[model samples]
Target: MKTKVLGLCAASLLICAAPVATFAQPVAPTPPPHVRESIYVPVRDGTKLAVNIYRPAENGRAATGKRPVIFVFTPYRARYRETDGKVVEAALNDQLALASLIRAGYVVAVADIRGKGASFGHRRGFQDRTEARDGYDLVEWLARRPFSDGKVGMIGCSYLGGTTFHTASTAPPSLKAVFIGASDLDKYDFVRAGGITAQFNTRPDEPPSVDLASLPVDGDEEGTQLRAAVAEHAANTPMAPLWYGMPNRDSVSPLTGNAFWQEAGVYAYMDAIKRAGIATYFWGNLKDEPTGQTLFGATNLGSKFLAGPGSHCVPPQGFDFTGEVVRYFDHYLKGVDNGIDREPRATYWLEGSNGYVRSDQLPGVESRPLPWFLTGGKAGRQLGAAPGVAGTAAFTVDYKLPPAEYFGFWPQPMDKHGLSFTSRPVTAPMTLVGFPVAHLTVTSTSPDADLFVYLDQIDAKGKAEVISFGRLKLSHRKLAEAPYKNFGLPWHSGLTKDLLPLAPGEKAAVSMTLTPVSRIVPAGARLRFTIAGADPRQRNLKDIQITPPPRIGVLHGGRDPSRIELPLAR
Candidate 1:
């Protein structure tokens, strides 16, 4: 009673200090310094989901009683294997909410999603929605347990945040709120953009420090054991060619028939969620999000974060959901009063020319267009297609090769063979909010072909920051096979289709989705789109048949018209 009263008084004090409700204004941006860790929490399923408990460890003493729980589900290793899950030898480092909530008298849990870390299960991304079920089960178990106050909230990055979407739609009774950063629900922008796969690109190598799920158990013959496992899984499944659940490499990819694709698509669940009246604040990386983020249009360049100089997007500060998460649970569970109702209700971060910008609606606001044309080549500043007529550029590289180094699922850099055409400084700053569509009428001598388009920001000092990029196979353009079947509506998934290949000098309207960005290319800086066969973040194989563009291209057709869309500040 006393804590609730004190919290209410504090909120009242804050309200009195402000002249009026500033819904458009940003949230309080600072946090106090106090954090602690708990070593364990076994879910109802007997799965000992490793949890790093965080709270005030001031003077090595913890508050005597149960605190509200903020649980984060991540695929990353929760703790080292040898610890019996009792000691958190280390914490999941990227998320900031974990640290901040502990200071606010809440118990923060970093739960390793099932199938990853020490948690036992065959690991694959969103596999059969097992993690989502784990989340619901954990909530009910925690609410009834003594260590918890029977209230739960969630937070995390990429896959961690992605899990929140699946679980959120289910509305676990114990789950009252969540802060999802860099995640998406649906195949909105995963693969088959414009109805084709632009793969065979190299993925960026994983940083040595970032944890990978398939680490081998210590043994005299580690390499052989690991290789055998990889081989077994690889052979058990040949899902990739079909883009379904394959083994090893693609168990987590969308192609996996696992629960991820089995469950109703994210789009299938939105109307249900709105009907349920659940309020969740969804967000995504301003930069790179491999799987779900862009699929639902949650984070695009314009309304999301745009690339910029000196902005090292390390340890994304975006997942830093603080005191607000606590208030959400309090309002729903303890009946404490917090101003969540009066705020924007939902928020997303935008890298405006001036720091971070906040908004109530993301897609509707930033999805508008800012069309620019590609002009000039190998020479001065030229971007997009020429005003009325379309334009083209051509470069050739080996098709049998991989673009860059590969690790886990992400590919390293094979960017050298890519071609870049840049625009001189914009008189002011420019922000791209949606996918920039490239209508390249192409041709190649090869019977089949592949292409990739990269949109980047060239800074004042000649450094390049990638905004958004996409890839596709020329054959899957119409999304068919020997046995043709037209799936549901094409535009709903929001994938830019890849079709119309090159045959010697033959041309076709080849579309590309410049991964959405919203960074301000500073004055005197440039915007460049590079066309190549691969990128560093995805696995790539050289599949290009070089015959170059016809020197001019134009807006072929589509609801978005043939052009790049920019999310400008209102």
Candidate 2:
């Protein structure tokens, strides 16, 4: 659906669940001569979105003009300030995709989004009209220039991929097409997986990447470097802005560049964008692992459910994107019948001991929802399909200190923070593709506790691998919302809303969301979950301090039990 909106004003959540793999395309085309190397373009908003136009060089080293414009916009500064984009130029100049597009009679426009690098303006996100406006303004402006063919198309993966969605939604007159790879359609799905916080671990296992507190102030040298990022003014706070649907005010401090500003998850606005009617070429990661890709420097729609094998910024395994993504633009914007629209709607890599298996749609296979029950006892067992009894799962631990795996992956079959009890292996294969709800009755020695859940699969070979895990602070149990601010934006809450603090023998239901997946847990393979206080990979956010060390106690009742609901594809 094509609709118009101001551009680059708002930002959204990210999708981090993806697979890993890499593959480049076959380089055959050479660019034409005469295409100017670097040409800056201005957007209507006073934000100059920097663009480098490349000519169709089938065999030449430099440019020759007059070709269709293929545009790639990014929030990350396109080039370094002083390096003269040398590093970016050297790396991307010969990139198979860009070079091929040039060779195919296309003038490529690689621009840095406003407020970053060469471009100047406030740093808004794709979820806003500013980005769309910036893109549309760039294309319309470029089309009239002597070098452009009056048509523009887009291509990129991860954050760049996300931009395609943003651009497509704002289908402008000059905007013809886009090639989206490994990205989530909604911001919430990308940012919050299955209704929980993200554990972005691929590249940085250290201090979370969006550390606003570490950002330089407005006058500091470091802040000067981010002058482009600083908005000319603040927008709304803790609320989405008016037209662009983003919160414009600085609910949080900007010294950290408003890390919480991107929380307007894209999922909530899909209906509006869908009504905009932007067609896209959606690509998933390697095996839909759990970490999705967004270009390293760009902002992504944080989602784990939609993630595949790709990394946060790039694909897990690179692709012959030159053929696929470029061809998409060539056909739609260039008026060439490249037969791209005739290809399968989706493509993916299968992880069954075999390589990738190309397919038509993303779900790839039929999957159904599975429900299990948790009896109130130490074991946190699963009650298959049987009607759930009014029961509960209970446990106790050393609440003085929490375990690490706060809410990501774990070592063994599951997180070992609390206690676990498993049922016999499934008699048949099973797969779950939805959130595993944790209806638990638990409490802590200190009036608060974080219930961690690690859902896993034990293969026929007798090895356990973690599929997904989650956690919640007890104080947040009765609250309708989360009370902390990462850059001042409130985090999503439903699990915490239901959390009930535990005293000895205290019981309550706190639902913990697990990762979604399409895998074959063979009959001999057992579906398991470990309800602990933490995993080794997580950083405890709740500053729970206990003066005198005491054990964390929680009890489970088999009749009215706590259970995890699994989605079955078989």
Candidate 3:
């Protein structure tokens, strides 16, 4: 297989540049001649949403038959002026994929959300209730259109994917199925996960301007309508202040005085979606933020999940699941007897093995927890099956540690900044297939400190590569029962009321679950659990910085044992 380096973008979904891989790419079906039309779709509030429709054509005219409509609701412009001065579809990144669906006899519609695109009206907040209601209106409208078969399905990635969940939550009658990729179900958890603020979430919104402005709909020769829409976007609410101001899930937004996070998240309306009984397919990358969210939806809402290896929205090199996507839509939208409903509920990619695993249920149910205790030895710190003699290892906080590139997926040299605990080489191959929980008994000179834990696989040659990582703000260490099914993993409420500040020089037990991973550890390879004070990738606006660097001590062996629990596949 050819090797490729993926570059991560700092968007909400963290889109990655496409990398050439050896996997067979999906070949598009020979497309039927299609007629493209641009028009305005008016919603409940009379706000005009810009929509582009691609319909199967015959003899240079739109076909006269009704077909299921596939809809894409996006904040990104439905169509935008490219640098080459040509207007093109901007919502769906892959035109070939869109064309394939169109070739399959589906009428594809792409719409600009309320503010960001060539649509009138300003955004209240990111994925707010109004936008969701607009989705309901749009879906119903598309179903009622002349050529529509009265069945509507949604498909998108990133923000567009989030819109699908938001729309599905409203339980629109005509909306039947949805395919979502790289979307966060819990907006609060994504923005301030583990009580650490994501820097990208707090960055200012930078809409397209100048040469890359939103394209005007057909018949707007002077670009009058597009210019007017851009004007209204000027009044759109700034997302940074709203995100930065809300420290807790229940915190009110400064702009709207509402619990924006709660209202914006699909988690709040999961029941509504379940009641709607929409067929759902979630595509997530194991190295991305949406894997856990995908598992949660699959377990709770009976959705099908495709978990693959890659950073952000990019799939592993050579791994293409577009054929499965077509199968899903055919089964649900067209009522085809494709037997997709009888297939495995979850499918995931294994890293070291470079293969896929299918399960009747979400991962972790058929796995056993393998605990490795952090123990101190004469040959430095080590991870063992049982607790060793009581001991403590000290490390000073390092604020200047360089951040890992590619959102921490790119490997960096270890032992340069943080304390490391290495496990003895394994005798046989072992497959770890789920979340890894870290339990640390620590004492810090400061009242609170951030703990960044990394799980690495080390070969006999002494080369180490990061597998997965997790972080927690010491003050947010208080665990709470999750509101939904969370696979029995550690849950931190991230609520202001649940915050617990540690006393100076006092021992505190912190437990956090690292991001999910699936990898096979070869025999003669060792596992290393490394803990650092800070990672420059994420920022905490409320982090307490002491005048002098604080010293953190990890207490282990007895009473307050520090260990990592790995989910070994059964």
Flag the better candidate by lDDT, 2 or 3.
3
Model 2 lowest lDDT segment of ten:
7-16
lDDT per model, in order?
A: 0.46, 0.47, 0.78
RMSD of each: 9.9, 10.5, 6.2
Q: Model 3 reaches what TM-score against the true structure?
A: 0.91
lDDT score, candidate 1: 0.46
Error of 2 at 503 (Å): 11
Q: Which digits, one per residue and each the tens of the lDDT, describe model 2 over residues 1-570?
A: 111112221111001123334454333233335244554466775654557666654344544456677778765444443223223331144432666666566777777665544455654543466676677677677678787777777776555665666665555666665666645543432333333233431122122122112223223445443443334313212211221122121133243244233443343344444453444455544323232322111122211112234333343353454566566776677667988666543343333212232323333133344556544324335545453445434455434333444333334444345566555677854534333456555655666644567767667676777665555555444523323112111233334334344665565545554444444455677766677654343332333334443344434434545556665533
Candidate 2 Cα RMSD (Å):
10.5
For all predicted structures, in order, the TM-scores are: 0.66, 0.65, 0.91
Error of 2 at 1 (Å): 24
Q: Give the Å shift of residue 31 in candidate 3.
A: 7.4
TM-score of 2: 0.65
Residue-wise lDDT of candidate 3 within 385-423, one digit each (tens)? Answer: 998889999999787766545344333545567899999
> In angstroms, how far off is 393's CA in candidate 3?
1.6
